[model samples]
Target: MKNFNWTNIRLFLIVGVAVFLYSFSGIRNEGRKIKQAEVVFVDNENFITKKDVNKLLKQNFDTVTGIKKVQLDLNKVEKSIDTNPMVDKAEVYATIDGKLTAIVVQKKPVARIFSGSKSYYLDYKGNEMPLSESETARVPLVSGSIDRTDKKRLSELLNYIYDDDFLKKNITGLAVMPWGDIMMDIRGYDFEVVFGKPINIDRKFKNYKAFLQDAIKDTLTENYKTINLKFTQQVVGTKK
Candidate 1:
């Protein structure tokens, strides 16, 4: 137009650049806030509760003295959890927004055995786990001469216990004889099941079931002292 004001123009351009930079910085911060991650979900089942998982994580990770950051290595944590005897498997994942998730499966106890100083928990697969004090009362106790129970025989006995519903419920204790015979103390009826040898327990259980179905109708006014299922396919009982 009239005279070009170079100084004013330069000043205005500088102001504009500063304003744009400030606005861009604000936008960048807003984007970061929008993209922030959150803990979205947790799945707990089969004796592996969310609380239990959290507790374990805290015990292993959070309690570490030098861990300045809360960066979670999911694979490492999952591997650590799998080492537990009760944990069958464990998985950990992170969501798109950065939420962490954990899933776990726990071992089921088939029978709890008490050997002298310590207790052993036997799973359905016959894997032995250390007995926890908190779980002592819930599972049935296996007492008497547990030292005589070798791995093979224990596995066989566990298989028998898992298959027979009556034995699972009624049998309270197990005593292993020197000759590999098993004596069981049952509940409800006042009798012990003299189950000889872990071999052919299925047949013996079937025989016992058949006999009780007929005999317990009115014959057991009191209780049976012992029901021997040792010889052949017969169920021999002694009255209390």
Candidate 2:
């Protein structure tokens, strides 16, 4: 007869009990009520507030407290939060302590476009964002009858303008003429600049910088009504 190994049987029984307890604990926790919710914004930009997030959560996942974990549609709640125009991203999750958490990211606007049908903002990702009455983003303003086809180039131009501190501060408005020409309105100047198309941006800006440096030295910036950048070799000036 083979000797019975009591140690092996004891070890197996202990492991089985541990696993059973762990599974029971998980089942109990799953049925536990959700205690509270926490809404956290990624940054303090205030483009979307905690109050706004709570309001949205209330709309989709109302009073989740006292409700079981398996009952809440977390994916649907996240999708609902993401549907807001101002929100760029939303992450929803439930903690082991029965607390729900949502992290939201707001869209950052690059420029404000004044279209004929509506006024909207162009975000950093080149998407249209609706203007908020509570907050005003001081970005470059693109004013004119800008068609949908022209928005991409115009957004690129605005992003370039935004990248330069001098341009962002001095160039206030961009007007797209009916003939497809782009004119930039300079701040504190009576005249406008004809920036032409969106080609050879580096060369054009370099020429423009040199011309501006010389013009400022000669105190002739106010003398010209338009500074043309259409030509490759020369910065043309049409005097008032």
Which tens-of-lDDT digit does each residue in 38-62 have in candidate 2?
Answer: 9988876677777787887778455
C-alpha RMSD for every candidate: 11.2, 3.2
Local error of candidate 1 at 1, Å? 54
TM of each candidate vs. truth: 0.69, 0.80
lDDT of each: 0.67, 0.83
Best by lDDT: 2
Q: Tell me how candidate 1 scores on lDDT.
A: 0.67
lDDT of 2 at 17: 100
Worst 10 residues of 2 by lDDT: 144-153
lDDT of 1 by residue, 92-192 (tens): 66543334455676776767887677777887677887665344424567766766657677677776776667677777777877666788877877778
lDDT of 1 at 29: 40
On a 0 to 1 TM-score scale, where does candidate 2 land against the true structure?
A: 0.80
Error of 1 at 115 (Å): 1.3
